[model samples]
Target: MIRDDHQAGPTLTSPRSNGARISLAHGGGGQLTDELIGGLVLPRLGNGLLNELLDSAVLPLDAQHRLALTIDAYVVTPWRFAGGDIGRLAVSGTVNDLSVAGAKPLGLALSMILAEGLPQRDLDVVLASVAQASSEAGVPVVTGDTKVVGHGQADGIYLITAGVGVVPTDRRLHPDSIKAGDALIINGPIGEHGLTVMLAREMPEIDSVLRSDVAPLNHLINRVMTRHGGGVHFMRDATRSGLAGLAADLAKQSGRHITLDEAVIPVRPEARHAADMLGLDPLEVANEGKVVIVADRNQADQIVATMREHELGKQACVIGWVGDDGDGICELNTLIGGRRIIQKPYGEQLPRIC
Candidate 1:
């Protein structure tokens, strides 16, 4: 467990451009990833809107509306996993990013990088999955590009998807709106996506029932926003670095302490077992279909109840709460009645899982 005094800071000690090269950990979406972005990427490219660092960039549109845009790349090694494929992952990931920003998705743009000698059948399957996921989310793929590279130059396939949505000027969700006593909730069980993919890739012989929880969350999020927009303060999808990453980030961004109750955090039995066997912390594992929400404390129960009505959020429950202002520390109340600080993982635990 990371100690509270273990402050997060720039991990790179050398000059920005001197003898530095990118590594897989830089894309792991953890502290090192943050350092890379904050230390290098932001300094060169950040603007007012980009500096906000929200999952989606909220841009001015007309007087009554704004635009939300997000893009993500899918490089899951197998490109296909239990319950979802790369195409589904690409579309769902993009759509969820928009939804957490309180936007209604308008359309998507997809680009594919294909390796030469890749089977045409595999491409067909991926495209079909993309179409089905798009239809399910009620979002259309408006435009796209495709390119082919030498057999060894690329993975079997790589998918990049960008999504655009419209948000009412008043509905922007941000950490600035969160306050002490706000309730933190999650939509369903965690760690399924990462665990499922890992098992499928590394331990396929194991007879496990784990499945990736990769699905578009626009409808479920829209439902909550429609009924409890006023109570909702902030929302984020727990993706690359999982729930712990998001919580740690929330504490830092909100400048408030956060407390999560371990007993109530939903982790399925199979996922927990797999995590233990693999020496992994479920809290730090990736999740594709989970969103951590901060809402008014008084309406936490109501929001959970509302979430339960949706298929995607049937296991929704309160997992934590925002505490008084502090140095942005997050603590977990363990199942054994112990308390420990929660910090973002320094690097990737499971790579190529998303």
Candidate 2:
């Protein structure tokens, strides 16, 4: 049975080990990522606003308003993928960051880094995707700049996107507000995007029709936040480190144990098969179009039903719940009736994975 009470319990082990030097795992959005940020980044550059590490920072714009600001850099290799291009990924990624923070995206600033000798046709395709994504998200790219670098100095194309969104005065979404007993919700299947990209590069011989699950989620998120408002405590877009990394980070930040059931967490059959073939855990792979919601159990049923009504959330499910078992630890209840710690990746599993 699910329990909703918050009580102090045993101290669970942290995801990070005593290590030095930055590695790809540090950027994989797991324990190592946390150590890099908490251990080094925070002590030096953290302020009241930056320390929280929310996808978007809520800045007080005036006595009556707050603005959410976030920025991201995209360097996905190949520039083009099965479901999206670099341009679309850049737009959708930034827009989702703002939306997850309970913001209504207003505008975006884009900057492009073009490598010398890159084909103009490739740039055109990426730009077209950016335009389509921006239009669909209802957030305009109001400003941008472009630069060219020496050949081989960079990938064919790189993009930097910064977004601004408005958060309603009455709503607040942050990990600090998440309490034990809140249900953990996932919008849809995980690992499709990461696996699709990996397969394109690593095992092109294994051909399948799988495509990246990359899309803008602002409309889907806006529905839930507007309807449930205060009942929704925290939300995050599962990106670089997939769901496993997200759970680990949430546990660490909220000082609560997040227990997930393997049987209930949704994964597409093809995605699971691909992950298995690669010796990867689907939960630890990356995603481009997924969101994790922490909300009151009382509101979870309604939330899941509402999510199903949206195309992006049609596969939404209640994956887990927060509890007071091991402080700042994340665990998974295995299908075989055992428990395992879900830790952040130590090094990059798939480099340039957006």
Top TM-score prediction, candidate number? 1
Q: Which segments of model 2 are wrong by more than 4 Å?
A: 1-23
Q: Score candidate 2 by TM-score against the native.
A: 0.92
* Cα lDDT tens digits for candidate 2, 1-354: 112121111112342454455666666665566666766665567666776677899988876668999999998876787899889999999999999999999999999999999999989999999999999999999999999999989978999999999988777887778788999999998999999988888888888777898899999999998788778998999998789989987887787899999999998899989998888899889899999999999999999999999999999999999996658899999999999999877668887889
Give Cα distance to truth, residue 129, candidate 1, Å. Answer: 0.8
Which lDDT value does model 2 have at 102? Answer: 90
Candidate 2 backbone overlaps, count: 6
Per-model TM against the reference: 0.96, 0.92
Runs in model 1 deviating more than 4 A are 1-11
Could you give candidate 1's per-residue lDDT for residues 7-74 as a string of tens digits?
33354656475888888998999988888876776667866776667789988999999999999999
